[model samples]
Structures are given as structure tokens and as C-alpha cells.
Target: MSLSIGLVVHASRRGVFEEAVESLSGISLKWVTYGHERDIRPLVRSLVDGHALDGLLVGAVPYRACRDVLPPRLPVAVPRSSALDLALALSQAQVRGWQPVPVSIDTFDHEVVAEVTEALHLDRTRVTCLPYDDDQSVDDICAFHQRSLKEGSGYVITARTAVLRQLRGALRVLNGSPVPSSIRSELHELVSRVRHERAGASGFAAGVFCVGRHGRPGDLERSRTGLLHLLRATPELTDAWIEDRGRRGVLVLGRRTLFERFSRNWLVVPVLDQARESLGVRVAAGFGVGPSARTSVVLAERAAVRAESENRPCGYLMEDSGLVVGPMGPGGPPRTGLHRDQDDRDRDQGDRLRELARTVGLSTATLSRLAAIEQDLAGRTVTPSELADAMAITDPSGRRLLRKLHAHGLASSEGSAQTHRKGRPTGLYRLAIDAALTGSADGHPLTAV
Candidate 1:
């Protein structure tokens, strides 16, 4: 099936959008375009819920603007302004006879600007790089540019499209757009990831096995060694671990097909029978199938307990609908079970949040911290001071992180709390957990994946 991808860009950048569409012609894609950056959140929510787009490609809109608003699981690709784009902007400035002696550049990363400056053989001292944060308004940006010009900057190069539009006639503006090649690269990556995830969502089966000595206390040590040896030799098992020495429970992970095959023909029965005969040991196995590895592990643990209760040398399968099918000894009834697709949506939501963290360049530690806070204080708003304490960072760093979240639409300032003293009110913020899960500010329930 052709993958459906939503393309978001400003309406004014129709030419660049068209160019991107043309460049991606070789791929089997159903491109849905959302022209206005301002209305992207609602449009993307509609596309995700109604049209079923596999992924999203956002251009023209800053990454921060769309990051928090879009559903976390809807793989989003945002193009970074490339070196080529900077090179072209510089070329335009030189063509217009703009002196490079004193240049004012705004909104581009300081590191990138430095690299470009060195590549272009421009004097670093003459260039003033004024990178704007998410809180800076157009007026604030324009004022910064105006101040730079008045302070002896002969030319201004800006990456902010709005600032460029407002100051074009007044300043020698070089508009920065994303490089087409960079956009194509990110799109290719997004498509590949979506394809992989779609394939993985089919679900897999896993299990846990409890092994114990049936004969005497002396045989316990021997049984553990034999069980570990057998598990290590089993190449069919994708993952195997002896979780507890005292309990002697082995966690095994594998494909559902393999488990089903073992259950139907009593293959596992014979294996356990042989172990009982040779080493005087018993094996109780429980199997589970789920949308994710974590969920499967949880179900497998429950299945293991049930297997021990049955006291049989047979495999048991736990279905998502809470049905248990097991004790498939020789000549048992044919295995019949149903798999539920209920948790697929929740798993997708998790995937989306991880992808969002990646796209926004958040560290794994930072993402984990956010998740912990969400879990501990479910519906309560948090202040920057509290968040800072939780994250073990400085107050300024905490405030900056909150601003970053707000910029990306992942958090909002609820209101301000009055302090007893005569200082400014403390800002209270709330994480947009519902928006992350449902893709709507109204907190609609997440749709099934």
C-alpha cells in the first residue's frame, strides 16, 4: 500500500512546496498538503483521525510550533535549514553589493552561522549572530535587527520569514528557506521508519517458563544448570533469561507461530517429558501475545503463574481478550484463539512521544523525566521551581525547558501563583499530555491504531 503523508507549509511558500512534491515523485506516496502554519494542529488532527496519514512532513513552520500540537505517534519530519540554504543567502547578499564588513544575522543557530562564516572566509568579529528564542515576537526580532543596523551592521541576514517580510525594504534581507535536498532526505527517513513500524505492529508472542527439580534438594542445583544450558542452546528463542535463582523462572521471547507449532503437536510436552525423565525436573510454561515487548512480558508473567497452578508439563497461551488456551498434550483439542488489536493505539502513542523527543532533540534523560512527572502528578499543573527540583536543574534551566515545551505546544502556562512576598507572580504550567495522546486541545480519547 502507498503510504499517506501530510505536508505542512505556509501558503506563501507554494513554489518551494511544489518543488518538494516534484522531488518525491519516485516514491509511492499520497501527499496531503496543509497550506497554513497557523491552522496546522487542527488540520493535522483531522488528517490523522479522518484521513489516516502514515506520517507528516512539516516545512515553513518552525519545529517548535508543531512539535507539541501534533499527536505523538504520527511520525513528523521537520527539515533543518541546511548549509546550502545559508550559502545561497550569502551569495544573494554579495550580489546586492551588501558589505560583509558588518553583518547582522538573526534566528539561525550560532554554530551553523559560525561554520558558514568560516567557510565563506568572512571575519567573525564583524558578524553579529542574534538567535531568537520561541518567546520573541516579530516586533522584538525587528527591533533587534534595527538596533544592530543602527549600531553599525551594514547588512542584515535573517532566517525568520516574518521578520524578513516586515524589514525587506528597510534592510538588505536574505530570506532563508530549507534546502530541497535536506527536505528529501528527511522525507525518505520518515517513510522508512513508518514502513518498519507498520510491519512490527502485527504483534509477537512471548512466554515465561518455571523450571524446578521434582526429585530432591540435591537435584535443584543440577536442574538450574540444565535449564540454563537448554535455554542457551535454543536458537529459536529470540530472548531468554533466568530471572530469579530462587524461583527458577526463565523468561523466553519468540514469534507466535513457533509457540503455536510447539503447542499443537505436543512438541514442548515431549521436551519437558525428556527433561523430567533425565534430570528429574518439571517445567511449567506460560505464553502471551501483545502489541509491544513490555506488554508481552507482563502477560507472560501472569501466564507463568497460571501454568504453575495447572501443574502440567504443557504450554499455555494467554489471549488479549483474557481467554487461556493450554495443556496441549498429545491428542489434545486443536488450538483455537483470537488476538485483540486493542493496545495498538496506546503503543503508537508511546512511539509518537519517543519520536517527538527525537525530532525536538531532547535527551533520553529529559524525556524520562517528563514521563515520570506525568505519571506521578497526573492532572496537577507544575511550576518551574517544582519542575526544576524534580529535574535536578537550576531555576533558569527549568524555566527555559518550560518555555521550550510551550514553544512546541507540549505545555501551556495556566496562570500565575501569587507569592506572599512583593515579587512577581510565579508562572504555573501544565504539560499537554492529552494533546500528545489525542492530537486535540479538547482532550478527545485516542483513536485505535
Candidate 2:
């Protein structure tokens, strides 16, 4: 019997949505359409009751909606095309004689490691997985370095390549040889591929929606601040934002270039789709990325919603029209998991802000408004207040939004210090005051890159 798969989608994106469904394997496809007004549970439950779902393809399902609708162990796919794209990239990389050296901060079983090595045909002697905690022993570092210098050791797949930099200085004193350049190249490429797979094919931007008790201090602010910091720290981010709507979480935006730059040693978190378990003050996060802004945003929203719905931590990838909401890491709370998706989204948004800041010399807030204005006006240069007005929010809201954007290094403000006739002075925010605008900071390779 053919495996049955169900799809949840919006009416507007039906065509492309169906195409994504057709791309999946191990199942015959079934589709269920939903709009902003309708409840999705009936459709989801109908599929589960009538068919053995090999997987599900979903649009952004709010957490409450998912808990009310979905059944346990319902294998769902999301933004299905992304999965196929990853599979293709992996195949191409293999054909090109690129061997993968998977690295995780957490340790995998020896059997699992052996199997991975055998499948990839890597030199088992060269494949070393050294798991380290914050308090790493010097002896462990020396031993790993010694082994890395031996012949056939082509790659060092560790969570953070930057961490290896400090170790390299230590190793040169303890052992003569350094990490092979080839290994470094391979490791870089592997990280690039994983990020590429996450973004799924074409260049695109994503938005994440977090809604709940915005007044509750720390949960929302801490999540947003930590995410922003993480993204900016990573080299790959292109752009990002947090909605000024006083919602539970921030909405992030960015492109694949940003993701590709920062795929090293990310902390993974879980998002759950069930509501039966909720720890007191437990926190969960959701993730979504794709080849387009709309899809990526939708997927991420669903993942977050799932985490909220089931009162559990969950992480998800879009597969066709379904979302693969997953359990947290081994020994993690079912209802509480860390989310890397938000971090990725934050990085992308940071990249966007940085780019804008480089060109205009503005803070992240100004850059964010500029981006929104750019899109809202269909790619036209816009005034800051004009941009704010276009967002349909209050002046105070605009100010707060701009402040947040400023934090991202995307925009700037200039105006008389005297208070305006109405009340507080509103500065004229613009793109960052960068050399690009002044023509002084040009031709620098660091700026160019």
C-alpha cells in the first residue's frame, strides 16, 4: 500500500504548495486547505483517522491549533522541497568526492560513529570525535592534536572551528605540525552544505512570529536578546527583526548567505506539538527556513506554534506542506527544549542590519524600518517616518522598533535636539552613515567581503 501524506496550506500558495508535495517519496499525497479564519484540527484529524500518514506537510500552525488538531507520532513534512534539495546537495557533494565529517557538541555512540565513517568511506583512524565540556583538560587537547597530525587525518569536524584556532597556538608548542589545510577546507564546506540545506535552494528571507504574554519580563526579552546576540556573533547573518507589536517572540528575517557563514557549532533546542506536559516556567522554541520568505516564515511560525500548542519544546524543518516537529535532545525535558532556529533567524536579520548599516551607517532599528519600507514601497528609497507610518504602528512603537533596529547596526538618526511641537523629538532615521555613502571607507577588502 502506498504511504499516505497530508498537506496543510494557505489558499494563496496552493500551486507551489502542491508542487512541493509532489516532490516527496514514500507516500501518496493528500491536501487540506486552510485560511486565517478556519480551524485546522478537523482536517488534520480526518487524515490521521482515515490514513496511515507516512508524513505531514504543514503551513504555519499556531501552537494551540496544533495541539487541538494533530495526533501523536503523526509524521508530517514541511516546506517539502527543502528536504529534496538537501538530499540532492548531499548526493552532489558525494559525487564530487567530498567526504563529510559530522561534528556535534554532544557525543554520538561509537557504533553510530563507526557506521557513519563506513558509509562515507572516511579513514576511520582519521575520524576522531572528541567531545569536550566547558572545562576541557589540556591533556585531551594535546592528544587530539597529535592524532590530527598523522597521515590520513584529512578533516577535523568539531563544533567550533574558531575554538580550534586557540588550540592551534597551543598545539604548535606541544607538537610541530598543525591542522591540515585540506581538513579545514572540508570542514568549511560541510558547514556550508548544512546551512545550504537549511535554507533549501534559492536565496530567500524568513520571518518568525512569537506571540503570547509580552508583558511577562525575561521570557520574551531574554529570548530576543540572546537570539540577537547569537546571530550577530555569527559571520553569516544578512538581516533580522523583532516585531514591536508586544508579542511573545521576535520576527526574524535574512538570507542563505548569512546562514552559510554561521553553521558551526550551534546549540540545538526542541519544540513540541503536544499540550499535555508543561513544566512550571518551561521555555520552548520553534524554527523554520526555506527557499522563500513566505514559506520560511510560515514553517517557523508553525514550529513555534507547535512548541506552544503542546506545551513542549520543539524544533522543525519544512517537508513539502508538513512540519517535522521533533523531540528534544536525549535526556531533555519533553516540554522544554532549546531552539537553534530562532538563533539562525536572528543571525540572518543581523546580517541584513549589518548590510544596511555598512551602506548607510544606521543602527539596527533604522535598518529594519528601511527594509520594511523598501519592501512595502516595492523597492523605493523612503524617509524614516514614512517607513514608520507605513508599518501602521504608533510613534512610540516606531521609536521602540527603531531602537531595536539601531541595536542591530542597520540604521541611524539625525535631527534637532529640541523637542518637537507635539512632545518628544523624533529624529530623522536613515540608513547607517557608512563610507559607502561618504565614499571614504571604500576599497577595503574587509568591507568588500
Candidate 3:
């Protein structure tokens, strides 16, 4: 399927981003341009409200400005200027007889500056960098450049257009915002994620709803009628195919996204409360995802049966891939449900994993998610941005998480990656979570030490 990507941009760098787009094909782009920073918030709001977008591409500045308006589920790619971009600007400064060292920089992360300078054999000690963050303002960046000028720095390098504009007349400045090949790579990655999500959205899902029995007469008929009535009245389930299955179960069929949303990402099902109070009976919902209707319905029925054993109205989800998530009551955070096939060894490993999380001062769920992400990485090193994207967290949070991981011996630096020649080398971290849990590369659990 063709992906519709929204491109939120500044008027100044339109050509640069458009230049990057020349290499990419098959994706429909809708541009949202803003002249000044103040215009970004409203412009992004408009883009989100009006457009049915599969993904969005925006720079760091614009992203920071309007992150609140962006949907949490929307796949967003924030393209950054890489160190290669910085290198090109430094080269231009050198052409003008300006040395790269003893320079002030703004908006670029300190790690990026360190990598680029260290690579070029420049003295990083002589360079000053002011990294960009949501708390930083144009005035704050301008003040940093001003201080650098007074501190015997020859020039300033800035990625922000506003910072560049404000300080250009007063300082010897270089524009560090080069559209490196990485931006295109980042877009391609976003497109891939969107396509993956689309494929998942089209997959078949079935929800089996079974009402709890009270040993009354006509229990089956009343249960069936009540389930159908509730399913039909619910707005979210309107698009789903509702069918009567056997005596006790009612099947609701639709796209995977529909159930994910209805179940609040499988954390909670709000309808359990509605049925409990209105129908005077407990309704257990179990959703299953599979390649076909028969498989999904079979799985859903099993899940519903599992939910039926609970004392109150609840729900559970069973995917064909062996993940079981549930007891999805109307409250608290969602916990990862154990797989039906979890053996004794697997259960022991899980216990050790929880202990590790506790030792590291993190919740079990967060650690479990980290373990899942590590598994997805397949032993490859990951940058903070990549880590953040995988975890659905902010970039700064990713950096902090990386630091925590490294500090706790859960992650290790595996040098850097220069995926494309033009940008700065991104530092990659190899996670050692598998080792931390098992105390060795093999499956043997760690002994107390």
C-alpha cells in the first residue's frame, strides 16, 4: 500500500528537504511549511487534524514544538543533521581559513560533536557545544553563541535557522544543517514501519465474548442475546462482523487495529464494566489474532474460556505467535501475560528477569519491554534514536535510558556506525541484558554473588 507521509518543515530549509526527497519514490508527501517557530504549533495541529497520514517527517525543532498535538500512535520520523553535515560545514569554514577547533556550536548534540572532532583529529577540548533540547529557546542558543564569541571563539556553527539568523551578523557563523543522505534513510525506515503496521492492520482478529452463568433457565439464550445487543450497541464494534458461535460464545471479527484500540492496546477493556453494571452478569472477552477466521476464532474461544475462570468481568488476548496478554480488568497498568507454552525453565528465567529489574530500580514491565526490544535487535548495536523509536519514547529519554543501561552493565558501547558517509558517526550500544539475567552468554541462570 502507498503511504501518505506528512512533511512538517520550515520555509528556509524547504529546498534541502525537497532535495533529499528526490531519491525517494512511491510515497505521497503533504508539506506543512511554517515561516517562524511560532507558526509551527498551529501548522502541525492543522496537519494532524486534516490529513489521514500513515507517517510524519519533521525536524527536531518542529517536532519539539508540536509533539503534544501529534498522535501517540502515529509513526513519526524526526530527521536530524548528522556529523557528516557538520563536517561539510567545517570544511567550508576551513576554506575560509577558519580552524574547526576553538569553535562554538549550538543545536547539535555533544556526542555528535565529539565523534566528528575525534575522527578528524581535531582537539575536542577546544570545542564548545550547546546541545538542543525542548527546554532550550532561540534566545538561549543566541546567548550561548554570544558567550562563545567573547570567549575567543572564531565562529559559531548552528543547525537552527532562527539561531543562524539571529547570530549571523554579529559572529562568523557556519550553517550546520546539511541534508545528509541519512534523512532519506530515516524516511525509508519510517515507510517500512508504516507498511508493517498496515500489514498488521489488515490481519484478521476475532473476539470471543462469553457471559458467565448463574444456573438460571434459558441462560444460553439470554447470554447470547445480551452479548449481541451489547456488541451491536457499542460504536467501536460497529464495523466488526458479529456472529453467534455455539451456545455461549459470540464472535466479533475485524481488523487487528480495531481490537487493539478497543482493548486499549490489550491493557484494559472498558466494556467489561458496562456489561457488569447493566446486564447484571460478568462478560469475559478474549481476543485472538491469526491468519484466518477459523484459527482466530478458535484461539479467541480459548482465551474467553481462560477469562471466564476469573471471578469478575475481564478480558485476555492470545495471538497466534504464542503471546498471551490479559486479565485485562478495568484498571491498573497492563501486565504481559505468560505464554501457554512457558516451561519451567522459561518461568525461572522470567523470575530472574524480574529480580534484575528490581535490582536496577526499574519496573518489571519496563525491563520485559527492554528484553523484547533486545530480542528484536537480533544482537545488533543500536543508537539512542533507534532505541527510542523501538520503545515509543522521546529521544532524550532514550539517551537517559542508554546511560542507565550502560551504568547498570545492561548495555555496552560497540564503537560507532557510519551507515552513510556524509553524516556524523552514530554511537551504537550493544545490550548485555541477556548476560545480566543469565550471568553468562549461555542459558544458565546467574547464581547469587
Candidate models: Cα lDDT each: 0.62, 0.41, 0.74
Query: Which candidate order results from sorting by lDDT in descending order?
Result: 3, 1, 2
Query: Which residue pairs clash within candidate 1?
Result: 68-408, 72-352, 73-352
Clashes of each: 3, 58, 4
For model 1, how many clashes? 3
Identify the candidate with maximal TM-score: 3
Alpha carbon lDDT at 445, candidate 2? 14
- Across 275-310, the per-residue lDDT of candidate 1 in tens digits comes to 565556787777777777777777877877766776
Worst 10 residues of 3 by lDDT: 440-449
**What CA RMSD would you report for each candidate?**
15.1, 26.4, 12.4
User: How far out, in Å, is residue 147 in model 1?
Assistant: 1.7
Worst ten-residue run, lDDT, model 2?
173-182
Error of 2 at 54 (Å): 30
| TM-score of every prediction relative to native | 0.51, 0.24, 0.56
Name the lDDT value of residue 380 in candidate 3: 91
lDDT of the structure predicted as candidate 2: 0.41
The candidate with the higher lDDT, 1 or 3, is 3
